[model samples]
Target: MAALQGAVETTAPVSRLHEQRSYDPADFGVPTGREEEWRFTPLRRLRGLHTDAPLPGGKVTVECDPAPEVTVENIERGNRRLGTAYVPADRVSARAFTSFAEATVVTVPRGVVASRPTVISVRGDDPAGAVFGHVVVELEPLAQAVVVLDHTGSATYADNVELIVGDGATLAVVSLQDWASDTVHLSHHHAQVGRDARFTHTAVTLGGSVVRLAPSVRYAGPGGEAELRGLYFADAGQHLEHRLFVDHGERNCRSRVTYKGALQGADAHAVWIGDVVIRAEATGTDTYEYNRNLVLTDGTRVDSVPNLEILTGEVVGAGHASASGRLEDHHLFYLMARGIPYDEARRLVIRGFFGQLIAQIEVPELHARITSAVEAELA
Candidate 1:
């Protein structure tokens, strides 16, 4: 973990992270090679990996053209608006908020409608130390914006991001991860929604030696809405995991999540765990979650768990679903009999599984890019 620490210390431009509590790997629970959640996961994959350390310069090359519709700013507001919150104090004594000294803050002004999608590219060049980066996004009332974050690096690193949506605002965020083969990636995303606000998040993971993504979202005000979507593909000897939590704390709030993944080749594993909680006071709330996985090879494995807890029966709707299996022979046979090749038929099915989530995105360019990425992975 010294490598991770060094990255955060030197690369992170924000200054306030030092004030917040720090996080230790043991705080989340060590992999016993026996726990149900860690059953399908291969903890041995992380053996001999470098410890988490800080990056040298805390400088990452961002490669994306600026957009005219959105405004990107830098902030060090000494406020804990975007930082760690869910970690138990007893297990971890890390700061709640750590600002990257060279952080980028994006703000969408009230009543503004961004026509083009904004792209933020974070590229890491250091191979020895961890790189800590923070991005805080705030949307004003009645504003509509679309933001895309792309993370690419040559070395192993850890990144943290925080997002806040104002009342009556609409923000769609799409994150794409394409790391190098020797990279180890860990990301934490926290979002807070206000009254009548709408937040939509879609994540696509395509590359990395070991990748863990955690997205925690909460509806803190009335009439807030959140939709979360994710897709991942793991090939030979790769390990990918996605963990999500959605909390409804206000009345008349709504949330929906759908995530799908595909694993191929020997020793490849993918895991998805989704948890949704409706508090006692959150009446008239509606929430639903679903997770599905497609195993492409005999040696590949997938684990999916969808859970929901409701405290009040007065809520409108609450449900969860999970499924993990291989491609259906009947469907493949039907396509093959119709003159389509078996390989192409399988590709079509995999595309359809992920296409469901990509279709929900409103940005045309982003949708095309995600679709193309998925197709390329299949090819």
Candidate 2:
């Protein structure tokens, strides 16, 4: 419920890693719920993804229908293109990296524009087994494309996704997590934006037992732009968490982030953590992040934190906003005064709250589907 608009200065030598990124899982200690990173998480529910337990893989399936101009491949661990655009910053991410058997790669050729969006589906068949996965999406120089990533079914899943946006290219990605009620999923998506490229990513998470997602962005050269947006609704006993980081290391770059969520029923929890760091050399960087949460019931809880770190005062502008509270009583009163039933008025308020964000995405089908899903949740 706090908003941070200023910068923080460091005097002595600081760690090179922003959040202690590492490739080896052994570099990270197991979680005991005492560390700052794991404080808000329920560690006992992770089912050994953070520990040394065996990741024998599970009944996980991946299906992709790529555009004619795109190339899709199933690559092994030693593939040259692997790990080129991302690094793991947490224990689960490192574990998913080292344990995933294969990686799915979707590539859009240089200078080619895809006519249709590329669709990829990841589903789990067994809730008892564990799944570790890796996904890579690349757009070469001057290429343009859209990617749709959907997840469903149930399992204990952890994975990492890499997005490479080349120079002067434009890339849009929509990631949807509609898992079953018994599913537990953890994922991290990182984007490497090249010079003058544009990248947009939207995350829609509506169902899960325990889901945690991290999306991050970094610039490879100057003039790159990135936008991250998300929406989620949690029911009783469902926990949804999203953490985002933007590293502005290049000059004249721009980044924006906005996320909104709603919670209902008892014991529903949501967490949002947004961090933006503007380095000293990153002059003329313009960035802003925002998050808002709505509590539809009494037993639900939410935690929203927005942080900004500007190492140099020469930047263009930087700021953030975060707020969490119940629905505005005046808005409801205004609707109820029109002869609308109490329940119908509540639905209208919630719909208007999320409909704005849903319309921001360029995809058409997602707009309708998410609206229908929200209506079902309200019912």
Candidate 3:
């Protein structure tokens, strides 16, 4: 680790270029395996990768059938900011910092409603090195759009992304993380909602050696709404963790979060932490969060912590719930006695567990794709 640090410090030209054109891992305060937030995660797994961050050579492609009438821009060389906060050095870990970059920017003008989904695909080849990329979204007042982000790598690398949505706009953002077998992924997504704006985020994690996804959203204006939805599967010895924070900074705002996971095989571990905060001035706030996990093997483990903090008494409603357990024997037996194959029966039960949330997606094609991917991973 020290050698890698020294290499980054010694490479003056590359370091300067990274600073001028892209996000530096060092700026985010990469973890040294000593921080409390990183205690549960294994840091030694990143020892083999090259410490020096790679240039933004990865290819980013966008596709939208029946494309939107609004202007679509692909920003190749530009500084993209995620909301108003700069990348604080102490808040970022070394591994997490390597994956930061200024992503392509997409802007939707006010009052424009897109007719099709916008698909953004990013691909990289530095499996043994570090890869960084970013995607910036700005929606004008009364604008409506659906954006899909798909991340995949040919080699093992850490990935990071930052997203921003504007005021009085509605953005339906979906993210899919599919990395190589030996890949280690660390992702950070930060979003801000403006007055009367709506932001919906849905994430599906299906492949990676070790994956940690953290999404932080803030409702900074009155009457704004934010919704977070996610589905994950950890099989065999994989480790997957998701942490979400929703901040209500204004009055008359609402937020809802629901995340579910399935764990199978020994040493498969999954962790979920949901945190919601209603500020003192945030009156008429409504928030709720729930996390559920289904354990298929005795050796598998899951830890869930759902929390809510209210600083004012004028809030309308707030609550949180968490549950972690195995499949009920009665439900399994009943399925088997009905002549269903054991494997098929187990698959049915797992699908039903996530089906409720999957059914909530407004897009038919997206809903079907998510369901098929979950089935394939669990099967």
Off by over 4 Å in 1: 1-59, 63-66, 76-99
Top TM-score: which candidate number?
Answer: 2
TM-scores of all models?
A: 0.83, 0.95, 0.83
Q: What is the Cα-based lDDT of residue 51 in candidate 3? A: 41
State each model's C-alpha RMSD to the native: 8.2, 3.0, 8.5
User: What TM-score does model 3 achieve against the real structure?
Assistant: 0.83
Q: What is candidate 1's lDDT per residue for 1-379, written digit by digit as tens?
A: 0011001111221122112334543443444555433454455553322222222443357544445756776656344544533331111112112324555777778888887878888786765544555677778888888888887776555556667888999988888877776566666676788899999998788788777776767775899999888889988878888877787779999998888888888878677767677878899999998877787877776666665667788899998877777888888999999999998999988888888788887667767877887787778
* Model 2 poorest ten-residue lDDT run: 1-10
**lDDT string, candidate 2, 27-46, tens digits:** 99987887655666777777
Q: How far in Å is the alpha carbon of 174 misplaced in model 3?
A: 1.0
What is the model-wide C-alpha lDDT for candidate 3?
A: 0.68
lDDT sort, best first: 2, 1, 3
lDDT of 1: 0.69
Alpha carbon lDDT of residue 32, candidate 2? Answer: 83
Whole-model Cα lDDT of every candidate shown, in order:
0.69, 0.87, 0.68
Error at 166, model 2, angstroms = 0.3
